[model samples]
Target: MSVSPTSQGQAAIFIPTPNYLFSASVNLGTPLAPIPLLEGGQRIVEPITGGTIGGPGFQATIEGGLAAPIVLNSGDGTKTQLAFIYAYGHAQDGSPFYLEESGIGGGPAQTTRIIMNVGGKFQALQKMYILAQPKVNEAKTLASVECYSVPTPV
Candidate 1:
């Protein structure tokens, strides 16, 4: 997707700020993409042919654990503060993973949220997908964090 045009007198290409940022590999456990949710917070696995309802959501991770503070910036020196909600765990793929919690934790804000500590390596390698909902804009995007870790012998 195209990022918001940079201020005049600036470069022509405005690098879209990544709404979702991650520190490490945390499997999403499943190929759960385009997770469908209808009005009134009802989950739907089937596709909705047509309907104007809520927007999309995302998944992300902070290296080690999010038990600490997360910094958000506008990519450039611009300090348009942003907020985020994150979770950690493994996907249903039988590997370790993490994800953002539902509700307010993932809501918008001007400051950063103190995430909970998520530690542990999955028994097997897994791929991760991070979905982000930009607060300032309507368009949303998905990012994947792939992990290829080999166990170290004791």
Candidate 2:
């Protein structure tokens, strides 16, 4: 599938191939606090304690980050978070990296784009199209984060 964001009659935009990047189970610490509002909705601020990610030619350790997701209630016993993450880590070879993701948390099949930065040998990541899939646990203490890259032409 492809995306067509046209002005008048422009052609469809390019769709890159799904390039697997990495997958990891992100560990979380307790949230600082919940700022409740909107009649049962709240904003959650959780800390990303640690994790690991590896795929293809890279393997990295998750250092720390912040998770700030706005929880919205449907009034029907359902709630979902408008989630955002700022994660950082280091490659096994001592290369530092950072990743940012924005998507829904506590929902099924939710995927969103990833903005990443890398140093050392993995610097090519800055020029690639990336995506992330994250699933939060019931206790809100863990997230399984998987990232993918869409291969674009040079």
Candidate 3:
């Protein structure tokens, strides 16, 4: 008796790999004082005044943006949960790319950090395949970021 060669072969699996996208240096205006809520968390807003996003084959000028962040403290008051939604305008190749970012942060109140993911659509055709990858921006503040495109399953 003999076994088939196909039975012994392993299946091929495709996984995504991350590629560097762009680095953005954001300049944020003064944050509107936090508004405390009677029931819980506080609401904060910040303005994105100006910045630059650049990388190989692509670069953009950050025209404007806004961020609304909410912070909720645990009953014990030792830990906090943060959620934020931000949107920005990018001028690239004589067109506009509207980008939005959102994320959640949880940790000790004193050392909380945000790991944001970004997605956007362009008005004109461009190297969209690079943009389709999962883009992540991790930072304590929105001052600066290194963006990357990670692979995903189809």
Candidate 4:
């Protein structure tokens, strides 16, 4: 059998604009001892003791048990890069949420700045929606969150 290249259907691509969900400042407690990785990377787990979330109609404190494990990759020797983290929190009404963020950040260890894409899921209630049908039924929003990190006083 022989194969041939042929023009096919048009590709449909949609770029979603990230709706501003909220701005949160996370407080990462003192990091635990770094666990050496096999690939010359180090895994560090920081405790997310507390924080705050603010948006259009929601505000809440970030719950504990949220551990952010950042894997630092030794890159060009000038600076170490790459970090990945997963965190969880709750809204003022006790509704829960989780966030996953990954990006490259490098500088001094204590003042390193991380720019990462944060995304998470949350349940929506009647108050959060105008339509009655969606408000009453099981509703949720998968949000693309924008987040930045700053060293907080412990």
Clash counts for all predictions: 15, 0, 0, 0
Q: What RMSD, rounded to one decimal, does every model reach?
A: 16.5, 4.1, 7.9, 14.6
Question: What's the TM-score of each model vs. the native?
Answer: 0.21, 0.79, 0.63, 0.52
**Worst lDDT 10-window in candidate 1:** 46-55
Once fitted onto the true fold, the runs of candidate 1 whose alpha carbons sit more than 4 angstroms away are: 3-11, 15-87, 98-154
Sort order, TM-score high to low:
2, 3, 4, 1
Each model's lDDT comes to 0.29, 0.80, 0.55, 0.45
Candidate 4, which segments miss by more than 4 Å at Cα?
1-12, 78-82, 100-154
Give a tens-digit lDDT track for model 3, residues 1-154: 1222343576545556657667677767777888997877888887878778788534778777776667787777654545353545555655555565544555522222223223343332232333322222344344565555544455
lDDT by residue (tens digit), candidate 2, 86-138:
88999877989998888775565567677878878888888877878887778
Predicted model with the maximum TM-score: 2
Give the Å error, residue 98, model 2.
Answer: 1.5
1-154, model 4: which lDDT tens digit per residue?
1223345765444333323445555666666788887877677766666667677634666665333345555555655545454556676666665555444556422222222222233344221311100010112111122323222222
Candidate 3 backbone collisions, by pair: none
Q: Which ten residues in a row have the lowest lDDT in candidate 4?
A: 129-138
Model 3 whole-model lDDT (C-alpha atoms): 0.55
Please tell me which model should have the higher lDDT, number 3 or number 4.
3
Model 2 scores a C-alpha lDDT of 0.80
Candidate 2 vs candidate 3: the lDDT winner is 2
